[model samples]
Target: MMRFIKPFIMPAVALAAWGTALPASAQDKGPIRIGVPTAIQLQIGRDTQTGVRMAIDEINAKGGVLGRKLEMVVADETENPEQGIAAIKKLTADEKVDVMIGGYTSGVTLAQLPHIARSKTIYMEVGAASPAITQRVKSDYDNYKYIFRSFPINAAHQARGLVDFISGMLKDEMKIQNIAIVGENAKWVQDLVPILKKGATEAGANVKLSEFFDTSTSDFSPLLAKVKDSGAQYLIVILSHASSDIFVKQWYDARFPIPIGGIDVKGQDQDFFSRVGGKAISETVGNFAVRAPLTAKTLPFWDAFVKAAGTAPVYTGVGGYDAVHIYAEAVERAKSLEPDAVIKELEKTDYTGVAGKMVFDETHDVKAGPGFVNLLFAQWQADGKREVVWPKQIATGKMIPPPWMQVQ
Candidate 1:
C-alpha cells in the first residue's frame, strides 16, 4: 500500500536521543561545528564535503575562526526528502552544528527548510537552485532568516541565462535555428523549462521538442531518437538528479549530430570526460568551475582543490567553499556566532568568490548578471579539456561543432 508521510515528522528514536544545545559561552569553546547533509555518493555531495573541509583547513591554518578550530560532520541525504529532514534534524538537534553547508536536489532542500527554521541554525545552501527556497525569506523573514544560498544563482535567473546563451551563442553566432529542450521532471526543471521555451521562441528559434524525463529514466535511446527525428539543430538538456553521464554516453555512441548544452550537474565534474570514457567530447554545461580566473581566488582554489581532492572541483564544490568562507567572515565581523547576528552580516555579503562576487538580493538569493554571479557555458573541447565558450568576456575557446556534424 502507498503511504503518506507527514510534512516534517521526526523519527521517534532520533527525537528521543536528540542532544541539547550548548549554553552561550560554552558554544564558543570547542570547534565550531559545520554539518553537511547531502547525497554523499554523488559527485556534487562529495565535492560539497571537500569544499567545506578546504575552507575549514584554510581557516584553521590561519589561526582558526574566533580562535576556535572548525570541523565538518556529514549525514547522507541521498536525494530523498524524508532523508533530508532526518539529516537536518541530526545536524541541528543532535550534532548542534553552528552552521550547515550543503544541498544538491531542490526537493530535498525545500523539505529540509522547516527544520532549519525551527533550529534557527544558519544554513549556507551550496547546491539547490530553486527560487522558491529563497522565496520563503522574502515571504516570512522572521522564520526563514537562517537560510541563504551562496552559489550558482537560482533557477529563474539560470533560465534567463539559458535564453541568453541560446540567443547569442547558438542563434547569432552559430546561425542555429531549431532547438529542443530536454530536462528532468523534477520540480526545479519543471519550473524552469517553460520560461526557457518562451524565451527561446521569443529570441528567434523553432521550439522543436520540450520533454521531461523521469529521474529513474535509464534508457534514453527513444528520447534521443525523438529529438533527432524532430530535426533539432541544437539541444539543451537540463539535469540535476538524473544520471547525465549515461545520457551523454548514449548520445556519443549514437554519434548524435546535435550540439548540446545547458546545465548538467554531473557533467560539471572535473573527471567527467574520463568517467564517460571521453563520450562527453562535445558536451557543454552551464558551469562556474571552469579555470578562467573569474576572480583572483578562482585559479588558486581550482589548483588547491585538484591537489586536495585528487580531481577538479564542480560548481557545487566551489559553492560549498564559498559558503564556508562567507559564514566565517560573517562570524568574525559580527563578533558572535549567534544566528541573527551572522544572518545580518550575511545579508551584507560582497565576497568575490571562485566564480564571481557573491551578494544576497532582497530574496536572500545570490544576485545574477555580468559583474556579479554570471553563468558561463563550458564545453569539452577536442583536446580533452573543458573551456568556457559563451558571453565572450571569459570564454577560453569557441564552441565547436561535434565531429558527426562537422563530417556532415
Candidate 2:
C-alpha cells in the first residue's frame, strides 16, 4: 500500500540528463543510493563523512532501512556549486540514489536544491548553515517538500550565545565598548551579520567595524591592522576551516591582542586547533555544537565516531551522524523511502540526537531549543581542554579574556 510522488522534471534535469540513461532497476531494488558531495577535504567535511560512514555502517550492520542496504556514492564537488549540482544529477539520474546527504557550503547546497526537488528524492542537509535553505522551504512550501536541513541556521543563535558569554565575562570586567565582526564574504555570513549585530547590541557591545573577506584570502594583516586601530575590545572572527586558521595565525603574528571569538572556531573540528597549534588556540573563546561532558545519548555516538574516525568527533560530525539516524528513523516511520512520506515522518521526528533533540519545524528545519541552542562559549585552557564558560548550567569552566581585552 506504499505510494510515491512522481518526479517533476525541472529545466536542470533535462540539462543534467543529456546522454545519460536512468537506471532500470532503480524502481525495483531497495538499495538506497545516497549522494554525498565532497566535504572531506576540510576538517568539517572529514568529520562529517566519518560520522556518516559510522552511521551507515551501524545501520547496515543491524538490518538496513526499508529492508534495503544503504550505499553512498560520494562525489567530489571540490567546493564548487556547479560541480555539486552535477554530482546530485549523477546520483539521482544515473545512479538513482534514493536520498542525498552532504553539502558543507551553503552556496553548494543552494545550487543543488532545485535539482533535488526536481528529482523527487530526499535531500538531507547535514552541514550547511544558510538560513535561506529552510526559510525558502517555508516560503515555498509546495515546491521544496523534499528538502530538509539538520544543522543550525546561521550564526545567529550561536552569536547570541557568544554575546551573552562575553557580557557575563566582562561583568564590568573590562570597558569592552567596541567590537568588530569579521567573516568570510559568503551568502551565509552576509546573512548572519544583522543577527550578530542585534545580539551584540543587546549585550551592550558596539559594532565598530563589520568586514568580509574572500575565503581564499590568506593574508589578514590588513584586516588585523584595521581591527587593532578600531578601538574594539573584542573581535568576532567567522571564516571557514582554512581561512580561519590563516586569520588566527595572522592575528597572533600581528599581536593585535584583542580577544577574538565567534563561529568557525570550535565548529571546524579539533583538527583546526591542531593545525593552528595549541598555543594559538589557547585563551580563545567561540561557539561550539559538541563539547565535553557528552550526554548519555551522545556518548555512544562519540565512541563509535572516534573508533571509526580514529580521532575525536567534532561538532560537524555530530550533525552528519544525527542526520543519518534521523533519516533512517523517518524511513522506518514511513515504512517507505518515498520522498513525501519521508518528509512527513521527518517533520514528526522527536528523537534525542547527539546534538540534543531532533524535530523539524514547518520549514523542515530543526526546531530551536536545547538541541538548537547547544551553542556554547568555551575557552581553550592550558591543559589542552576547551572548557565551557557560558550559559551557567552547562559551563564546565570560567571565561578567561586575554590581556588585550582588559581596559588599560
Q: Which candidate comes out best when scored by TM-score?
A: 1
- Give the residue spans of candidate 2 off by over 4 A: 1-28, 170-175, 265-267, 283-288, 370-373, 403-408
**Which predicted model would earn the best lDDT?**
1
Worst 10 residues of 1 by lDDT: 9-18
Candidate 2 C-alpha lDDT tens digits along 83-106: 888878887898887777777778
Lowest lDDT sum, 10 consecutive residues, model 2, at 9-18
CA lDDT, every prediction?
A: 0.83, 0.68
Report clashes for each candidate as comma-separated counts.
0, 1
Candidate 1: where are CA atoms >4 Å away?
1-28
Error of 1 at 362 (Å): 1.3
Residues 1-408, model 1: lDDT tens digits: 111111221121011111233355654598989998888888788888888777777766565667677888898888899999999999998999999999888999999999999999998888898889989999999999999988878888889999999999888988888999999999889779888999999999889999999999999999999999999998899997788888998899888878788999888887788888888887888986678778877878787777677788887789998888888888888777889889899999988888888889988899988789877898897757987888777788878777777722
